[model samples]
Target: MKIGLYFGTFNPIHVGHLIIANHMAENSDLEQIWMVVTPHNPLKKKNTLLDDYHRLQMVFLATESFPKIKPSDIEFKLPQPNYTVNTLAHLQEKFPQHEFALIMGEDNLNSLQKWKNYEVILQNHDIYVYPRLNSGEIDSQFINHSKIHRVGAPVIELSSTFIRESIKNNKNVVPMLPNKVWEYIDHNLFYKK
Candidate 1:
């Protein structure tokens, strides 16, 4: 199987995430798109993040209706401050029979050089980059690379930060989240300040 790994903290899964995953699964060469819920991202702040289990459950609830998409907790079993290179290596070892591609946004592509062992990541895996609003043009070096493919997925400006803030401020977030995810957040009183 050819799988596209969409890694994120997914503080809470939102519609924008589902749209991108569905687009990749249907429009790209990937047979499956796994939403790898990172326990903690080395590059991001953790203060506002929900617990790893809650975040993972949100991903599961949001993606349950989509057969091509799956929620993964692979990073929870690995080391803290999870690095993409290490997770990719572990995944390769565990699933040698399958081909793995990394799915990321154009914003991430702009910062690829700063990631640990980015060279190895570029050399080993296929990268499917979806467009993001205001991410600017991709650098020429990556634009010409054989392993990097720019996918024409819809660029939704929605973000987990926005959703969390809306919830904290007692604003409605139903439009941004999956119904079940919104229900979960509502039931658990998550993100309430």
Candidate 2:
């Protein structure tokens, strides 16, 4: 089995996340896409992040109905300030029979050099990149690489920050999030002002 790891904070697991995962699952040779919910992204601020467990649960709720997509809590048990290369190493060791690939946006690819052990990640794992609006083109060095694949997933402008702000301002985020996710956020009064 080939798995694509779609790592994210998934602050609320909005529709844009789902769309990208679904597109990858259908368009790529991947057998499944695991939404690897990072406990803490070293590059991003942690003050506004929801609890890791809460974020994980919302991912599960949002992806439960999709057979090819799964929500993973793999990062929760791993060391904090998780690095992609470290998690990939752990996953490969644990699931030796399965082939694993990294799924990300073009924007992330632009900053790939900033990640820990990024060269190892590029050399060892296949990468599926979805386009992001205004993200510019991928670097020429990676454009023709066999390990790197560019996917034509729709460009969604939604962001977790935007969703949180909308909810705080009492704006309807129904269009931006999965139905169950929105219900969970509303019931739990998450992102309240």
Candidate 3:
């Protein structure tokens, strides 16, 4: 089985996220996309991110209707401040039979050189790059790399930070988020001013 890891903090899983994940799952060779909920950094402070379980729950709610996309808490069990390369290695060790790939935006691709042990990641796994409205130029090296694939997925400009801010300002961000996710956020009074 080939799995595509879509990593995000998902403070609240919104529609734009689902669109990208769904597009990847439907358009790419990947059999399934795991919406990996990135654990909040214990070292950082004063962020609006929700609790790990809450964010994971939101992912579950957002992806419940999408069969090809599933929510993952794989990063939660890892130590804080983990890097992508380490996560990939850990996942490979845990599930040797499955081939793991990364699903990222072009923006992340542009900054790939700065990631820890990025060369190793490129050497071991494939990367499916989706379009982002605010991305910079993709690195020349990756432009034609064998392991790098540019996917012409739809450009979703919406972001979880925008949704959270809208909710805090008492604006209805329901349309921006999944129905169940919105309900959970509303019921829990999350991101309220």
Candidate 4:
């Protein structure tokens, strides 16, 4: 089995996320996409993140009906400042039978070289990059890699940062997230200032 590991904090799962996962699952060689619930991303600030378990729960609730997508808590038990290289290594060890690939947005592609042992990742694992806002116009000449593949997915402008700020300001975030996630956020007061 071939799996695409879509890593993210998923502070609150939104429609845009589901759309991407669905699009990839339908179009890619991947059999399934594991929503790797990142406990703490090395590149992101820790203070801005919600509790890992809370974020994981939101992913679980939002992707419940989607068979091709699953919530993975693999990073919760791993070391702090989670790095993609470490997570991929651990997952490969745990699920040796399944071939794993990295799934990310093109916005992160430019910074890929900064990631720990990024060269090793490019050599060993396949990468599926979705188009990001304003990056679609980039010429195909810029993308030159046998390991990298571009996905034809809808470019969604929605972001978790926007949703978090809305909650902090007491703005309605119902449209930003799924119904279950919105209810959970409202009930638990997540991101409240």
- Which residue segments of model 4 deviate by more than 4 Å? 41-46, 136-142
Best model per TM-score = 3
Give the true-structure RMSD of model 2: 1.6
Which tens-of-lDDT digit does each residue in 1-193 have in candidate 4? 9999998888777888989998999999999999988786556767768888889999999999889999999989998777889988998999999999988898888678789999888888999999898654443533888899998888988988998888899888887788998988889988897
Model 1 poorest 10 in a row by lDDT: 38-47
Q: State the C-alpha lDDT per candidate.
A: 0.92, 0.91, 0.92, 0.87
For model 1, residues 100-119, the per-residue Cα lDDT tens digits are: 99999999999998999999
List, residue by residue over 28-133, the lDDT tens digit for candidate 2: 9999999999886656766778888899989999999999999999888888778889999999999999999999998988888789998999899999999888
TM-score of 4: 0.91
Model 3, span 1-193: residue lDDT tens: 9999999999888888999899999998999999999998989984798899999999998898889999999999997798999999999999999999999999999999999999999999999999988787777899999999999999999988888889999998978988899999999999996
Which residue pairs come into collision in candidate 2? none
Q: Candidate 4, 68: how far from true, in Å?
A: 0.7
Off by over 4 Å in 3: none
Pitting candidate 1 against candidate 4, the one with the higher lDDT is 1
